[model samples]
Target: MAKHHLDPQYLDPNYEPVVNRSGNTPFGDILAARMQRRTIMKGSVGAALAGLMGAGLAGCGSDDDDDRASSSGVASTELGFKAVPVSTENRVVVPEGYSAVAFLPWGTPITGAYPEYRPDGTNSGEDQEQQVGMHHDGMHFFPIDLKAGGNSSSEGLLVMNHEYINQNALHATGPSYVNGLRPADEVRKEIAAHGVSVVHIKRDSAGVWDLVHGSPFNRRITGNTEMDIRGPLRGYHKLVTKFSPDATETRGTLNNCSMGPTPWGTYLAAEENWHGYFANKGASQPREQVRHGVGSESRYDWELADSGADAYVRFDITPGSGSAADDYRNEANTYGFMVEIDPFNPQSKPQKRTALGRFGHEGVIFAPVREGEPVVCYSGDDSRFEYIYKFVSSQPYYAATAGGYLLDEGTLYVARFNDDGSGDWLSLDLEDPDFAAKVQAAMGTTVGDIVFEGFENQADVLLNTRLAADIAGATPMDRPEWGAIDPNTGEVYFTLTNNSQRTEDQVNAANPVANNQTGHIIRWQEAGNDHAATGFQWDIFVFAGTQGTETVVDGEAVVTLDDDNIFNSPDGLWFDYNGRLWIQTDGSDDAPYQNNMMLAANPETREIKRFFVGPTGCEVTGVVSTPDVRTLFVNIQHPAGNWPDASDPRPRDATVIVTRDDGGIIGA
Candidate 1:
């Protein structure tokens, strides 16, 4: 049997049920009703009161106009390019009059001292550290001069996440499993392949982008790099380990997937599916460990390396005699949080923001920040029956203040969706009596109950986030992936990537379809159109699939998808400077869809048009546009598609830059 599990929660029989409220009714109906209610409330309020609030709400518009303009909506500057057709060919397919150039493939040298890429996979671990990491995912670009604003689009530091590694492609003769053990060198190289990469890139006068080799800004942060632990659980007893006796630091980042860019010029790399990387064959496992899917056998089996060094033994998180300071038992608690890296300051250590709460974090997106208003961020737990989360900064945000400090003090809340088209943001704080009661009801016990060993304090609540969510009755979602916020509007959108394990009885109002293969996008407007509001109204934005396969609610199509824009498993989502939404996928390259693709959509009009389709057996993900909006970059991961060059014996993952021939803004 294959030991690799994509998400261990899928195999758990006691998975919690997701909350869905708009079953069998067109999501639009629910949205329209919410808008009407808001309008009525506004009208009923005294005119004097409305006038008093006008100044503070000048830019915050109601969803009524957006609801009206969804389908026929066009950019102030229209996207006039022809749509790209679906393809089964082993090459990237783009719209007519557009051009693409492949750059920054795996093992590309960032530092001048590293050896060039060897197709035979013979690069040493040190070589891998100095070169670009493998499996590119979400990314962001930060200009060297922060004050330049849009003019700095041509020059910036491009930072991207190296999600995971392909064992066969990383080793000369493939990974070795000799009597349940791996070679130390091979394991080291694999560790070097995970984490994030920062490269200085510049577009020349000829309209071409190239990596600036040997630039001081170019660097790679691998799984072996030192990182600091911050937030609620920083120095908790659960995090003490031999590696960090004081429990204030940890080593490296693993399974970096999606990313988030902060207003203060830093990168937030999300850790996803990291539990499988560790192994604990001890007699008994902690409740939190089992909940997060830490299994007995290692996914990579790196713990069995013959080197006997602490670096190799850390993967085995089993307890030993004496205190946690003498063993690696608590090492696993150190991962699964949003790691903040200062792209501009290479010397700055990455900090794990535990206040965000950790459990297969897909990505974190901040809502519009106003001075003196709390900074709010939204994230989704990417696993079957997982929950969506929001964090509110305890202190208000002031742009003039340092940006890195905003995340340190905050309250994390899990979402609870009711059956009546309403939802609540339940605080995860252990001090809240109501929250504790809810947890007791869900788990059938009190906090003092010894059966649930870890719920001792605030630190425990932050460490075992998933368990806390289960106790608080948060609505489970269908594998929530990346999220994006509309710049022109305050609406929040999340991709509920497909769930094939849902049975007919398991279906909910939100996820109405059973065995959902093609996923849908869900959007919500916070109460009073405020990011800090605890309540919100939501509905399905688009149901992804071929034209004839859309799911209907109340005899009306939820959202139309067609041949020119069919897609599945919406994994990555981003909003360009022009307010255009870009959707990317990671799914089967079957007929009709042909290949994973990138699409352009007008969220206002619900118009989706196919923009580009990726090569065979490759995931099309990680999209970011320059401030000028004329240049776009997308990543192709794990290319079994053999894209960019089919003739090359060894295919490598790469980033491709797209531009219009007329030098016009992309998708225009």
Candidate 2:
């Protein structure tokens, strides 16, 4: 059943690019436009606003003009793929005949008792705790395919990951605190509201997919919920805590980022920025302290002012004679694992798979499952110079299997790249000779094994995956973000977001470019398309650049294009089922590229065209599509608070849908 998602007119023939100054160049610009149209023309695949785009993304362009010269050949009535224009006022947009709907909006109820969100931000942590979580990111829709003569919602459970909370947005005036201190009341509220949200959605023959709010299946997995820790690293001394009566389970999930869907109908969500939650005493600590993995980036700043409680005082692990014995010195070890949520079972307890060694996980892209074969997942470490890891589940995945717990068992490994394009999937086993060699080499067995001996526990291995990967000698990358797996081919694509901080001297084969601020997406086709293979070939697919400027850093001329081709940072990513690669940007210091955007690209063509752009002070994040192709959902997040107070009515960041008119498909 080939379904049509967009209309032939997804981009009407009359659709004229605002500034497609093909073969045109601006004098005194950083560089001249070498814009030329080429074959396999790839274009950015997101929505755009006629107004803001004209104002904000006026000159922004792609790597080539040859890309814009041809028609997509997709007709509205036969729309194969398209980009539609929807309204954009600090919100996500889709093409005309398309619509934007808000789901899991900020302060949306997570629990049944939570109060309704009053746009003014008065919503408290009390009732809001159990409701749908905030800042929805990567999501998936599993259709409820019922046999004949059955009443089933065309829709299924909408499983989404809440990246992080917008305190100012979540609370009307930023994070609520008592005298600059996080109130336990507030912490408690946030704890209950941060994790995964599973709610049922249904669409009728008329194509309206509405949320069944009271659906018994609606559920939320918060930070306080108990999660069983599994994998090689389970039950380690480092994970044993005074809080965990049995020492194997942990209390919460935080910064849940991008996701993956199992062939067997389960949901996989990766926890990112888990490091920001701990409180480190800076680099002044001892070698043991540094070796313990505590650095300047811990979360909670709980050290500043202890509300004298776990909700506040638990973050600081300073061993300077202060009694952390009864507190959470070992608490940081609990986070940084891949959490599995069964969307079908609302009452199912979310489990953190420790076998997937932890780090700042951006996503978990699984290797397409094959019966009787090992299941593999690729993940990127978000921080600068972090490593990319892969998890080979111990058991083979069976699509028809009744049990969904297979994901809990797996052999987690990290990658170490070679200059000659060869790599190794370094395993993190305490008893392995390779592990002993690394410990002896880095820490000298005496201190190495003891300092990180807690990693001796697989829980330590899974929870502190970075450390395990470190001991395994994995290759550090240029701040890896989201990853996309090609559905047509089994190749895995991961983004190495910009890292300008690295000096030329620090450049290595893996992170080949120095001061490589504008990042690149690296694609690797597993040998035989086998994710379980220990080796794979790799290449730099698209080096990000400004629309029409050629950039030469330390001597490599990456890309040159027109004004529209210019792009600063690359972050969020999604490879639509159609093979169109959708890219979202997060420009941190590259303020010149104002109004971060989302670009649609053809992976095979490598042609990136600017499809949709965000509003003033908003980051374009969270991208997903319904199966029908009629509804396209994108999230406009953290909109404008970096500019002024959260109350400015100029625009409120929210999700919007885009559907074509005449009931035609999108981008046909």
Among all candidates shown, the one with the greatest TM-score: 1
Model 2 / residue 101 / CA error / Å: 4.1
Error of 1 at 505 (Å): 2.0
Per lDDT, the best of the predicted structures is 1
Worst 10 residues of 2 by lDDT: 23-32
How many Å off is the CA of 417 in candidate 2? Answer: 2.7
Please give, for residues 304-349, the per-residue lDDT of candidate 1 as tens digits: 7878878879989988878999988987899889999998777899
Question: What TM-score fits each model?
Answer: 0.88, 0.77
Q: Candidate 1 — which pairs collide?
A: 70-604, 70-605, 70-606, 71-605
Q: List candidate 2 stretches off by more than 4 Å.
A: 1-101, 146-153, 175-182, 204-206, 280-313, 316-325, 402-404, 430-436, 443-459, 504-515, 549-565, 588-592, 641-653, 662-665
